[model samples]
Target: MTTTFADLTTMRVGGPIGRLYVPTTIPEAVDLLQRVAATADPLLVMGGGSNLVVGDVGWDGTVIKMATSEFDIDGELLTAAAGVEWDRVVAAAVDAGLAGLEALSGIPGLVGGTPVQNVGAFGTVTSDVLHSLSVYDRQTGQVERWTPDRCGFGSHRQSVFKHSDRWVVLEVTYRLRRGGQSGPIEYAELASRLGIAPGGTAAPSDVREAVLALRRGRAMVLDPDDHDTWSVGSFFINPVLPEVPDSARGCPRYPDVKGVKLTAAWLIERAGFPRGYGTEWGDGTVALSSRHTLAVTNRGGATTSEIMKFAAHIRAGVEARFGIRLNPECDLVNCSF
Candidate 1:
């Protein structure tokens, strides 16, 4: 059956797909995924559809929507099918009085997508609690569990699943803390806003409340009626820049990737594209969220081309001024730069 990518994405753009699979069990998902890979049929594996931006022309391949729902909890260790909503997982952990996930309470998308991009917020990343994973490896056609080290988690990314459409996450295991409020506060802004001291602890529910409040204030929380949230969270990962040398300052020098990470939003604001940059919905067809400089929104009706064009404009403007190229945080669907 044909389904529009627009309907499958939070951005509300894109075209259609040739095929769609909604597997409800492990064997079924693995079987279909292997078949597609073996037959050389292009495939797109996705979760909550909260972090994608498909092209307007549509994907000419099969799209697998993981729907498996089996989940079990044992003490502080929790294993969930990839189909489970990430936020729901957090809620369950909270209900169980677990503490490690409270800082990540409001993030959208499914559990499987968490490890894919090392999803994080309020200074806590999924990698921090990851213990193991059940993944379908396309190369060996093996379904197996992987340790945290095996996942190759770095800042905002992982190694096991990057740049390759190979492994399909089936289930994930997390090691959560027991009988504690939450981790020590590490984000200055979050701590300040909550009137809590840095490195201090608070109830998990309190932490979640503060995070949701902050996200809502910035329009980072999803709202069906707010076009400002018609985005893929932060558009760019903060750029890590090498220390500036006196010689390089005379010319243009991008981040060395071995130095300190610079905030992309800070650079954008410095580049003159403050929050709510660009014409309402003209030219780039994308607008900076009026509440947050980091998000690029689809003003009513926008194509992937338009959104990307606006992104390019921001990247260019930032590079011209700071000599740093902001890499996008969202995965590009059927489009390349």
Candidate 2:
């Protein structure tokens, strides 16, 4: 039987896939990739599928799911294969008395997706802890180790492999500190939750719980029972603009190398689109997550078109009201704004 993309993705949308290939071992993965690369058919490399929005037409290519779940921790070094659960990696690091990854707790997706996006939360990013990666180079058909500097990580959600099909991550190695304490808290809300001043520290386990709690409140954590959690964690990447418009004087701003990062959720709220926008307005198939302004959720039986329409509606609203356009953080598959 052919499996649908809905069966594989978190958003639970998409049509039937042409073919699905899951490689459980390293040799098998490399060989499969090489063979696919030599073919004229298109290919889609899928991880946790947490960051995807697929259309009703679905993909017309070979869908390769990274299924190798293997990991090893030696002293302060942790090695994880592409398919290992990302949260599981954080938990293991904390359990082993490591500190670097505790702030990233409760993030969805598999381990390999981290470096591709330079995944970050709270104050730390994957690049901060990553030592190296075992990548299968599609161009040369060779497997080699790549260092952090080679990944081209900078600014919000980017890397050499982020949108490129030339490099496929097979495994990742992270360098962590051998302390039981969490890294210095940088997020004000998280710091307040831990009852610590900004820049203060907490135990790793404590940090994990606190982060998870915060995510749960925003419906960022996955929960099958909650309609609010039925969307991608955040629909928009916080827009980094050169300057804040006079109309958006009250909008929150953060400094970034790219310029000024505007708070997307704040813009959405200020634009008159509050949380649960669709439930109260249009067809109930799609709506803003009840807990998070940045989330565009599927209420029930919502099609990918509904999600895109709703997202475009939000983007257009934000632009008209604030003079800033929001970009989606989720990976759109066969779907466009």
Best-fitting candidate, measured by lDDT? 2
Q: Rate the local accuracy (lDDT) of all candidates.
A: 0.82, 0.88
lDDT of 1 by residue, 1-337 (tens): 5688778777777888878999887789999988887786788999878777888888888999988887888988998999888888998988888889988978888988998888888888888899899999888999988887877676445456756778889999999988877889978888887688898888888888888899899988888899888888888877665565332344333333366556678778878898888765466457999999999887777888888788898998888887778898888877744
> TM-score for each prediction?
0.93, 0.97
The clash count of every prediction, one per candidate, is 1, 0
Q: In terms of TM-score, how similar is model 2 to the real structure?
A: 0.97
Could you tell me the lDDT of residue 57 within candidate 2? 95
Model 1 misplacement above 4 A: 155-158, 244-257, 281-285
Q: What is the C-alpha RMSD of each candidate to the true structure, in Å?
A: 3.0, 1.3
Per-residue accuracy of model 2 over 90-201 as CA lDDT, tens digit each: 9999989988999999999998899988888898899989999999988899999888999988767878986788889999999999976877898999999999999999
Alpha carbon lDDT at 198, candidate 1: 95
Model 2 worst lDDT run, 10 consecutive residues? 5-14
